[model samples]
Structures are given as C-alpha cells and as structure tokens.
Target: MSRLYGDPIEVWTREGRPVQFVWRDRLHAVRRVVDHWVVSREWWKTSDSDPGERRFWRVEADPGSRIGTYELRFDTAGEGWLLMRAWD
Candidate 1:
C-alpha cells in the first residue's frame, strides 16, 4: 500500500521499466524493483475522470552514500509520473 502525494517528477524508463527518477530536485537511480502492482479504475470515480490501469512499482533507490525505498506510479492520463511516497 502507498499514500500518494501526487508530486510531479521526471522519470527515465527503459524497456517500459523505470531506471531512474528526479524527485525533490535530486536524482536517484533505481537499483531494483522490490514489487510491482497495477490499479484498475477507482470505484468512486466518475467515468469521465477514470485513469486507466496505473502501474505502481516499489523500488530501492540509491542516492550517493545513502539509500532508500520509494513508491512510484505512472499514470496513463493527466500526470505522467509521480513520486507517491518515500521510506526513511
């Protein structure tokens, strides 16, 4: 599970998989994908506002000497990429 903040970000993906991303003005390279999941349409949302099939990836990020795990999601509409949450 993740708490999404909807914070916009710049992501670089290769072969449809995220390799790195820039968040909070810092660049972090994703070392591994710990988990993966997909979210279907929100039940509460109206048909006009439905965002199709969101892809969520729980990934380990390495930023220089420190490392952290973050949750990222790719939206098919509206926002392209977002950093949902980060674990300390």
Candidate 2:
C-alpha cells in the first residue's frame, strides 16, 4: 500500500527530468525513473486558476541508504512540485 502526501517539495532536474528532491527535510536522490505520464483536464476552460498539464514521474529514490518508491508531480500552470505518494 501507498500513502498519499500531496506535500510541496523542492526538486532539482536534469534534462527535464527529476534528479533529486527535498521532501520533509530529507534529500532524496532519484536512482531510476520507473514510469512517466501526463494528465490534462478541462481543456476548453481557460479561465480557471489551476488549469494546465500535470506531469507525473514514478521513481525509485534514496534518502541516505534507504530506498523507496515515490510519485512526484509537476504542475505546469503553477510551476510547483509535489511529493504525491510513497510506498513503504
């Protein structure tokens, strides 16, 4: 099972892909990108404040020596990053 966080995170990218991220004061280095996808909704509605494509990356990351699976999200409209989920 996975736990949902939806917490804001600071991410560093390389060649448009996440290389590392800081979540809850720990720095997680991405070891591998397991999967990727994009989500776009309400295409015709432009007046909304939060309307844009959301890019998702499922990755294996390690903070220190413990590795874990994480899902990260990038919101193009807000230019923000989030730690969406984690597996234990």
Candidate 3:
C-alpha cells in the first residue's frame, strides 16, 4: 500500500462504485459513500475565502451512508495537493 500523504489517491464505494467525493488530510467521518476526487481552477490569489480559486477534489459520502465527504485541494503555490476538508 502507498502512504496517504501528498500522494495521488483514488477512492470508491464499498460496492466498487465510482467515487465522486473530496479528500483532505484530516479525521473524517464516513457517510453513505467514501471516495476522493480532484479539483483545480484558480491558483494565483491571496484571498482566503476565494471560491474555486484552487483546485479541489470533493469526496461526498452518500446521504444514506451518512459517512461524509472528503475534500482535497491542490495548492499551486505549494506545488502539491493536500486534504482540506471532510464532512460528517
């Protein structure tokens, strides 16, 4: 297995379903689904509340699962991506 740090990873449902949620480097809860997605749009910005400024992958757990969504953000300034958020 590969380390889950600064590495490109893919997630899917327990039943082998296509994953469409986000992933971040934090403790997250599992909902109806579990997976990781990639997202990137803007990179050159100083604002913190900028929406879609940075690329991010959102892993949303299925509603029935009540797991949660995993979110990852690609930091152009940092030269890599990191886990940024998780839903519970």
Candidate 4:
C-alpha cells in the first residue's frame, strides 16, 4: 500500500543527497535511493524570478521498526523539504 503527503519535513543531507529525515516526529534513515529526478519548465527563460524547480528523491528508508519507500521533494525556490509519499 502507498500513501501521499505534503507535510513539511527536516532533512539531513550529505553532498546534496538526503541521508536522513524527520517526519511526524520520527527519524527515518535513507537506506537506498531508488530514483532521482527534477521537475520544472523553462522558468529561467521567463521574466518570473522564481525558477519553480523541484527535486525529487524516491528512497528506501528504515524508521527502526519497518522499512518503506518514500518520496521526498525539495523546493529550490523556497528552500524547503516535504514528505511527498510513502509506501509499505
């Protein structure tokens, strides 16, 4: 089963890669990165200042009791991290 969320989260990164994250007051360690991608249009060419680029990481993680896959999103313009989705 899978779930979706847009909750803000705190992440710890190493060399621009998420190594750990805190979601709903629990820490989840990133075991492996399943996929990585960027979602954005040609915002840089437009007059709008914000690039509107977002980076996404699909990762396998362990929260001590169980292991699951999660989708994490990083908003470059706002400099925030979000727990986008989770799988069990």
Q: Which predicted model would earn the best lDDT? A: 2
Candidate 4: misplaced stretches above 4 Å?
Answer: 41-49
**What TM-score, computed on C-alpha atoms, does each candidate reach?**
0.81, 0.91, 0.33, 0.89
Tell me the whole-model lDDT of each prediction, alpha carbons only: 0.84, 0.94, 0.45, 0.93
Report RMSD (Å) for each prediction in the order shown. Answer: 3.2, 2.2, 10.3, 2.2
lDDT of 2 by residue, 1-88 (tens): 8999999999999999999999999999999999999998567844476678889999999999799999999988889999999999
Give model 3's TM-score versus the native structure.
0.33
lDDT of 2 at 41: 58
Which candidate would rank higher by TM-score, 2 or 4? 2
Question: Sort by lDDT, best first: what order?
Answer: 2, 4, 1, 3
All candidates in order of TM-score, best leading: 2, 4, 1, 3
> Candidate 3 lDDT, tens digit per residue, 1-88?
1133444433333443334433433333334333434445545644565444445555554434355455555554454445455444
Q: Which of the predicted structures, 2 or 3, would earn the higher lDDT when compared with the native?
A: 2
lDDT of 3: 0.45
Best of the candidates, TM-score: 2
Q: Which residue pairs in candidate 2 have backbone atoms (N, alpha carbon, C) closer than 3 angstroms, thus clashing?
A: none
Give the C-alpha miss distance for residue 62 in model 3, angstroms: 11
